[model samples]
Target: MAAPIYKVAIVGRANVGKSTLFNRLISEKKAIISDIAGTTRDRNYAVCHWRDLEFYLIDTGGMGEKSKDIINQQVSTQAIQAMAEADLILFVVDVRVGATTEDRILAKSVNRHKTPKILVINKVDNNRWRQNNDDFYRLGLENQALVSAANGVGTGDLLDQVVTALKKIKKKKSKKNGEENIRTIKVSVVGRPNVGKSSLINTILGEPRLIVSDQPHTTRDSQEIIITHNKNKIILVDTAGIRRCSKKSGDDFEKMAVEQSLENVWRSDITILVTDVSEPLTWQDKHIIDEVIQQHNGLIILANKWDLVKNKDTKEYTNYYREFFGFARWAPIVFTSTVKKLKIGELLDLLVLIYQEKHRVITDNALSKLLADTIRRHKPTKGAGTKHPYIYNLKQTRTNPPEFMIKINFKAILHESYLKFIENNMRYKFGFIGVPIKIRVAKSQNLQDK
Candidate 1:
């Protein structure tokens, strides 16, 4: 049996290099690093291994003076939650800015958690800056490490301290049999600004892991969290809200964020595209759908904010969306209200179902039978030439965006409509309800000879 991964949270005030420190510790650019304060509104998580010890590293939004704004309050709440769950806390402070009243107040809050903490004085790039590190000692934390996260200086000493601290804490044994083999599905929740994507993820997690606000673009970085539900491991990714490229061109930060959001869809196994029920489907939504389909990624459409809709007839809305988004007919649609917590559990169930279907494979014999029956029912029309395209063999080449290869007669050009017909037949015969399938054609050796 393996031991549980100890959790270490990097927490501090906004713009104090928390995200930079997180990226440094994980040795990856998983979190977005920006000079703007409050750039990271959600708690981003990753696993870090130091000196043979594996631990979970969490990067939380800055915590400081409380504000009445819902987003600020939510961010503070999430930081506190991370502090409570962590076995140790990395209290980060900026050396150049020095410690302020907010740092003192935040220090007091960290002390209340009763968790062991190490003060990390960041941005101390050279010996001159190292002298100023003593100024942060006024915060009253005993242990301290100096480092410049941006340039990766003095991080080794910081990690050594972390490892030494972890050695004292006892860890529980993990079940060895089949536990390490559990498959984790990466589900990326994406949509336009203010579409309740973060709210929906918080509802499923049953915690305010992300900051929710009425303002658009509240979340700027892609946050990844792992949760176990019904013995299934799921990696839920909450990405930055995507805005139109034209609207984002003026701001380089926003442009980068939008690009990162699109990249998340490409990297994920499945994408949950959230849309507002009150608003009509727009060109941006269609553009995102096209990207998902073009990437050959599995997709699920979620009509969020359903409670705001006055119409109780969901069937009518469903029919309208079906017609409006006919291009994504393979994607299943679900109505949800993140505020009301309606069908949130059902959403997770559907996520698991679709993930399973995405990796489903069809037997060669079954695929052959299905192809024969489909051709007999509706024969394909002739293409540019006089001879019609005759499929000689069909076999599934791979799964996860299931790809199939078909050997056909030479010079038999299959029309786009004919390919769609074949795909429809494949979907109807095999239950690939919420996944995209790719079909390829090749000329048979015998047909090539002719």
Candidate 2:
């Protein structure tokens, strides 16, 4: 049985090192850490285990009451939402700067929730700042701890206290949940800026768990959200929109955001490429597709904003994408509109199916037959004076984006077209929909053994 996941949110004003403390607690650099104010714009969640306790540690954006910027307001709203859901809140503050109005505002917001909280006085690495930490108690939370998240001082004691609090919360609930050992399917939603990637996720979740805006790159960090459907736990990762690679670019945060977004593709089991249906596909969209295919991730192409198109011909759009993205033609495409709530359920069903296909395994007997039929249908043409590759046997070596190994005659070369033919035949014989298959060729030591 899995222990119920209790949310412990780390909230503070801008540049208080909440993200740094979050990384220290989880022991993983899952959240982007920067000195820039409000580097974190969304709530980032990661599983944290301390001693005998396990819970989700949520890192939220800095809250400020004075910022009138729309994005800043959205950031504060996201932090408030995190506080509302958290079972325990860590109200982080910088001891050096003491408690300011921003900290007071965030503290008031955190207190609004009946949730239990601990005031974390951060950056007290030396005695000078440590002695003056009494001002933080003015926020009115009784429980408090002092630590420097940058150098990892006093963090272990802080976590010990956290574990104690979490234990109480766990005992009070006393809920025995099942499916602790169930594997989580990771699906990364990626696309160009303002293409509705986060909106698509919000639609599927049936709530605004993520911040949505007309502005590009609203989602800076790749946020992981866990949802259960039909007994399957799926982690949908909402990634930052990737811009065209150029020497001239956005700030360091945006650059890091793009790098992390691409990195999610490599880490996820499936990658859902969301494109704006109202506009023509650009090189950036194809660039993301290539990355997904290269990573061998189960793929689903989503055509977003279907309501805006005059010609709602799904087939036409599919054909156009297939022609342009010929390399990734195996990917399944779904048309979605967050505003109209189109195909939201269908997308979920397809996601589950694609995840299953990624792990589909074929027996060697079936693979041998597939190889024989492929060769008989379209044999490799013999090159002038050079022997063509003679493939004798084929077998699946791995699953989850299935990989096959082919044994060919030594001192012979196989054309790329022949490999394509084998891949095509494999797909036709066995359904490997929405999954990329890897075919590796190995030269046989003996040529005439067969």
RMSD of 1: 2.2
lDDT by residue (121-173, candidate 1, tens digit) is: 99998999988776777788999999999999989899999999988888775
**What's the lDDT for residue 203 in model 1?**
91
lDDT (10s digit) by residue, model 2, range 1-450:
564568898998889999999998888888888888878988888888888878888898888766778888888888888888888999999998988988887787788888889999999888888899888788999999999998999999998988888777744654545666666799999999999999988888888889889988889989988888877799999999998756775577788989999999999999999999899999998899889988889999998999999988888988998998899888888888989999888888888888888889899788888877787888875433387777879988999879998887887878877888889888888989999999998888774645
lDDT of each: 0.86, 0.87
RMSD of candidates 1 onward, in order: 2.2, 2.2
